[model samples]
Target: MAKNSALIEPRLPRGFVDSEPADLAAVEEMVAKIRHVYERYGFDPLQTPFLEYTETLGKFLPDTDRPNAGVFSMQDDDEQWLSLRYDLTAPLARYFAQNYQDLPKPFRSYRQGWVFRNEKPGPGRFRQFMQFDADTVGAAGPEADAEICMMMADTMDALGLAGKYVVRVNNRKVLDGVLQAIGVADEGQKLTVLRAIDKLDKFGPEGVRLLLGEGRKDESGDFTAGAGLDPAQIAAVIDYVGGKVPSGNEGIAELDAMAALFASAGYGEDRIRIDPSVVRGLEYYTGPVFEIELTFTVQNEKGQDVLFGSVGGGGRYDGLVSRFRNEETPATGFSIGVSRLASALKLTGNLSSRPATGPVVVTVMEKDRIADYQKMVAELRAAGIRAELFLGSSKNMGKQMKYADKRNAPAVIIQGSDEREAGIVQIKDLAEGAEAAASITDNAAWKAERPGQYSVPRGDMVDFVRQIPAVAAWMEVNARP
Candidate 1:
């Protein structure tokens, strides 16, 4: 007798998700649109490995205790520590540094891939997610930053978010000046201040003030230690954040310069604007930073309406590649969280509501006549129609129809003995049947419409199916020449 086997239950790690075909299709559609916009702006596609040497990917994440603190890391057999890339930008920086001599100046490239981070996951916050990035490396002027802002606006418009979103722009230099004016010059303290400011939308001004001063206790009574700044320092930080100080004035001026750059290129404030509160949470950003925020409001779990918030952000990082070489290499780019953006589109009803439909299924009525069914499926496929033959165990007609429905098949090719003897095939429009059955009130009219099924000669089966409006429209869009 064989020993009893142990069955292992399949599971996915927290913050990771598996996508179904419909979800995958929807995401692919969104990515294609974004990629089109990037390509239009002359950005070429590039890809990098999921893993990189820990030393090669320099430590730049904000609020981390160590270099690989925020990333998933593992040790190789050769006693070298490797890490999963926390963001696409880091790998790009490594690539540029390694091949600087052979690459073009101001190398323009776009990449779309999954990035990993090791962090506590929350609602809509995953450890692994897709990011689409476009960067101009080696461009050192505000013009490059302005172009990125403009391209971000265009990308949003391409994704059908033209009037519903705004790109908030700011500069790190202005923030640095603000800190200098406030007497809070410590590097760790600056990060603490940035993090507190980042919580402005959630904690509000008063809560943030508490955080900047002593500390803050949330509604759940969990305390987040403050930056330990005095009252005067807190006031200075708050005034700068509110754009009421000299350094704040300098930040506003820089934003105005960027806005003018955009306007000269014909982009207006409708798409991009300067906001002092826009401090991106990344340590590597040395110059201007911008965030794409959706202006629309949605209800949260607490049943209160709130803004959709930022879906993407980027800024100039001149020091990333400087770590590799002794010289500064300016680069700026933008990245959109693919899943979050898709979720926003869905919530706003901008995404397609219909689930992706599968191919038409040719039912197997006569098991002995499987060859005939295969022939019909082949003809449909050859005519640029998506179709498949039933390859199930059940031979019952009712079961076959149920299987077709389960497959989301638009229609089913039926050739029973009677239809075969009549030298014809039946094309049962399952979609039409469901729609008609749901709405038809008059039995006589329903019978007269014959909305569910049609019969055509065996030789004309493909042509007849092609004439159906739904199938015809699909073919017009997806069929190859």
Candidate 2:
């Protein structure tokens, strides 16, 4: 056996991640746009500390059962066990109840923050991720749910997911009625049954049928024990799911009511949908549960074409505040999974990937002229151009150009011996020049390429640097999304 050591392996435990800058940038854009839409709808931005008392957040969260049960947990100075929030909705509930007297009757607010869950991370699941949510408290009708659905529709349109996305809305109570009709007495079991039903797309009708009755043998050769119900009971669950669709009788009633609300408010079914598979996982949801599903397909982890599925979801938690205030306070909210949304947008070719800055590297030709190089950099900076000086000790001109290539520099300003003698500054259109060089052609032929490299006087650096906006515009026009 190998020698034992106290040090653990250098790796992340299954569900955690370190997001890349590209990923964060796309998400940031989406979050900013969504925030603007929320603010337009009159929701104030509110923030609360990530750490809160265990009693503060309450215990109805689907995964909150015991210590370190669902969320990351730690003990406080006063010996109170605190867990990271599982969702923004719970914390908003806590915020409303604590400041009940101070806040307006219908406290409207939105928050963007990181939420944690200590659950198994699969294809699109992670231990920690960011959520953007908007909520309205003190509202007690389907109108509240209706507003959330409207916001959901607007959010998709604002994010450019308009034609490609749809919102599936349903009431948790409607599901409860289905469960009651199916004879699932316990709420927990009903939720489990709903979760299984939600996976109908993944498992298909046969798989769901097995899950409703005895159990299922999945593609991975794993057996998921079913609710263990009789044939008649299982049939009811199957029938309920089958009955849900955009243009159906029961679904049409709910959709018609919501459509009338949005239609009066200027949104319509051209973007919204009513699908029964939207059984959201949060235990706090007491009313309508809405999910934004991507109709497009993206490559899965296995490089297979799988419908990317729902990218965001939320529902009404009418009883969340009751956990603390001991009185009913109805609240409805929507959350956008920014990271997943960004990923889907990226795969669908909807997100722009332009690296914002194109550096202008001033190549140093003379070691003694370091001061002149510094002056050139200063001039570029003064003109509001992204500029830097080549710090490499290499004297070879070819190697200096290579450095600019690595930096993705769009222009390389060269005041070489020849140019210095001519009283002109040799400027290379590094972006185009580099691209030209990368093509399969002779290096000398590429180097002597006349259309790219230009010469200007030393005093004209700013004017020359100003050409980038046009270059960027031209590139944008020529490129395909």
Candidate 3:
């Protein structure tokens, strides 16, 4: 007997997930909807490689303790560190810098790809996930940032989240003014303050106050060393976060400017709001910062009602490209966390619950007549109908129908020896058959209803199947005219 090899258990890395077929289909649908919105705004699609030179990506994240804290990086053969991009914007910055002379100024482009982050993931957070980003590079005005906010709102509405969400806008300069007012001048202390403030949603006002002053120790007894500001400074910071200070008025003014732009564009306060609380936790944003938050609440793992936070956000980074070129090249963009948004949509019942319809299965009645089954499948497919020939070992009619049902097939094509002799084919509407089977009881009633099964000429199989409402409706929308 051959020696048994050690059995290895199949497992995914922590904070990573495997997307099944249905999950992938849902994600694709969301991407298509978002892509349509981006393209409508005249933003071109762009594809960038997943790997970038570590230096090119840069260490912009607020965590400065470890230079490579948030990113996944490894040294290449040439001893140069290459990191999987943590976000799309950084890669876009690198791309723009590399092709600065050739590419169009104010390069408006959208990209959808997987980004990796080496963070301790928890509920709704993952190590690897999809992001759809739209950026307008080389545009310096607040209007460019305003346009991004508008586009973000439109994209959310496009994804069936019209009244269910809001785009909260704020300005880093406004926050900077607040920090200056409070006398938190040091960059490290300022970042710590920003980081603490960013947790306002998770840790409410009192919790944030604790962090702002001394520090916060969670339920797990983990002490997060805070900024250690004095009581007056903490009060100022809290007041700023609450939109109650002279320092935040600059940011408030910027938000008002953006609001005017939105109003002129017919996007009223209903869609977008000037919320000073939105201190986006990114060091790169030098101007306006916005976060898209779902207004609706859903039950968490503990069955507690919780708000879905920050589906997507972006802001003006005037210095990202300037990192490469000495001259200032202002840019602004927004990115939707594809997985988070999709999951939220699903939970809220806003997501399309349409079942994943499979190809119409052409069952093989006889092994010798496989060629005939293939021909039927070919005809259906040629007419732009999704179809497949059953290649299962079981030739049992019942088992074939079961397979079709398992596939969520709209219909099944049948051609037994008797049907073939008559030069015809039987098309059973699996969808309709299942529906009728759930309701109808008697054999006579089933035969009289013939619920979804229909017999048509061999040549007319495609046309006949197309007549089925479920099949035809999908074809009309998906197939070519």
Candidate 4:
């Protein structure tokens, strides 16, 4: 006998999750809506591989405490290093540079796929997630960035999130200019200050002040080293983040142009607005940056009410593609965090929570009648109804019914020896039967009532099954264009 320890445990990695049918359906619905918005804005679909040469992704990895930094890296057969892409934008830059000659000057495209990160997962954070991104390469003007913001606003509206979300816009150059004005010249300290500003909403000004000077210890007593700055430098940084300081930086000019475009399009402050605290943590963002912050509040696992934070954000990376070519290739884009947005929608009751209706099950009544059962299934599918023929080991009627129920099947078709000889099939409407069974007191009365059972001619099985509410609803939803 094999030892129990020899068996491999069925489990998933900590930062990964399995998508059930309903989750897949919700994501599909969201993707379709987002695609519609992107297409309406004249963006075409593009796709890239999951892995790329690690160098091709550039050295800009997200800040993480893990040893691997942020990406999952591996050595290829030829000793070249390859990594699972940390974001869709880097792969896009590589693709555009390689195919620059044949492509149009201002390439407008959208990509949707899974991106991996080698970071610790907590609560809503995961190592692998989906990002739906739209980018406009070769466009340096702030208008390209403005259009992206408008499209993001439209996408939220299309997803029925109107008035519940706000697109906060900012400029990295504005923050950079602020750092220069304060005489903070060290690159490491500059990055630390930018990240501290990004955490204004989470930690408030006092917590950020500590991050700017020395460091702040969390409730868990883990001390994080901060940018060592004098009181003057810390106060300067705090004043800027509090919107107490204004600048005449070029980034400010670009933000002004974007703001004008937003007004011209009638996208009021409620939909999109300029704010200083939106310094996206990515190092590649050179100019305008923006983020979608959900304004709604949800109860956390600790039962405390907290505002749902950013679901997606991105900015211009004029320097990203320049690494591949001598001349600069200005690119601006944003990504929608599909999984995070889906989770928020699920919590707010905007996403459908009902389990997806399964196929119409054709139960095998006789071992010899398997062929007949398959024929019925084929006919139902031909009529655009989802269905399947039971291929289980048991031939018992009770066992077959139990199997269908487990499958969430709408109805089950039964043609026992007597019904087969009579040229008729019995259809048991599981959905209606369950509803009626809840009201009936006695099991005998429930069986006698046979609430949703129907008998029809063998040739009429498909048509009768299609009339069942659950099956008809499924067919209507899944109809081909």
The number of the candidate with the highest TM-score is 4
Clashes of each: 0, 0, 0, 0
The residue-by-residue lDDT of candidate 1 on 69-136, one tens digit each, is 88888999999999998899989998998999999999999999999989889898899999999999
lDDT of 4 by residue, 1-481 (tens): 5675577789999999999987888889889999999999999999999999988877787563332367899998899989999999999999999999999989999999999998879888899999999999999999999999999999999888999999999999988888898899987788788788888878888999889988999988998789998999888777777776466789989999999999999999999999988889877899999999999998777798888989999999999999899999999999999999988888777788677898898888788878888888888888899999888899888998888888889999988999988999999999899999899999899889998898899988888888899988888889867
1 versus 2: better lDDT goes to: 1
Query: Relative to the unseen true structure, what is the Cα RMSD of model 2?
Result: 5.1
Clashing pairs in 3: none
Model 2 weakest lDDT span, ten residues long:
244-253
Question: Model 2 — TM-score against the truth?
Answer: 0.84
Candidate with more favorable, higher TM-score: 2 or 3 = 3
Off-target runs (Cα >4 Å) in candidate 3 are 1-3, 247-253, 443-450
* Candidate 4 segments whose C-alpha is farther than 4 A from its true place: 1-5, 64-68
**What lDDT is reached at residue 133 by model 3?**
94
Could you tell me which 10 consecutive residues in candidate 4 have the lowest summed lDDT? 61-70
lDDT score for residue 254 of model 1: 59
What lDDT does candidate 2 reach at residue 327?
A: 82
- Against the true structure, what is each candidate's TM-score? 0.94, 0.84, 0.95, 0.96
Candidate 3 residues 1-481, lDDT tens each? 4579777799889999988767877777888889998899999999999999888878786587676679999998889999999889988998999999999988999999999999999877899999999999988888888999988888888888889899999888888988887788898888888888899999999999888888999988999998889999888878878877473365667777788999999987889988878887878889899999998998777799999878989898989998899899989998888988998889877676566668899999899989888988888889999899999899898898888888878999988999999999888987788788779888888778888788899888888888887788778768786
